[model samples]
Target: MWNQPYLETCCRSALHRLTLVGRPGRPDGLKDGPCLRRLEGMGLARQREDGRFEATPAGWDRHALEIVPRKSA
Candidate 1:
C-alpha cells in the first residue's frame, strides 16, 4: 500500500490507457493533454521525443496496483 498520489477518475482512466500493452501507445488527441501532464508532474508518465506520452515504470507499477482489479480468492 503506497501513498500514491490521488488521481481523478478521468486521470486514472488516462493512466490506464497509457499502460495498455502494445497496440500503439498513442494518446486520445488533445483530450488527454492535461491528464498526461498531471501524470508527468506526479512522475507517473513522460512525454516522448515525438510528442507522445508513455507510462513510466512508476506509472506501470501504479497502474498494476491501483488500476487493475484483483481476482477474488
Candidate 2:
C-alpha cells in the first residue's frame, strides 16, 4: 500500500513539511500529526526516536503506475 511511489511521495512531502519547522527535536505540529499517524498505522511510515518519520523498506518497494500517453493518430 505505502510502497507505492505515489503514497511514498505523499509521505515524504508530509515529512518534509513537518521537519521544516526548524524547531529541532520532535515534531509536535498538528498539520502532519493525523497524516503521520495514518501512515504509521498503514506501515508505510515509522517515527524514529528522534521524532522524525522515515519510510519503511516496504514503502520503497511499491511503485505507482502512471497512464501512458497515446500517440496522436
lDDT of each: 0.83, 0.52
Clashing pairs for model 1 are none
Candidate 2 residue 6 C-alpha distance from true site, Å: 11
Q: Estimate each model's TM-score.
A: 0.82, 0.47
lDDT of 2 by residue, 1-73 (tens): 5344344555555545434433352364566677676667777557778776654544333212222234668
Q: Candidate 1: what lDDT?
A: 0.83
TM-score of 1: 0.82
Give the candidate number with the greatest lDDT: 1
Candidate 2: list runs displaced more than 4 Å.
1-30, 63-73
After superposing candidate 1, which stretches have Cα over 4 Å from the reference?
A: 21-23, 27-29
- Backbone Cα, N, C clashes tallied per candidate: 0, 1
Candidate 1: 10-residue stretch with minimal lDDT = 21-30
Please provide, for model 1 over 37-61, each residue's C-alpha lDDT reduced to its tens digit, 9 standing for 90 to 100.
Answer: 9999999988877777889999988
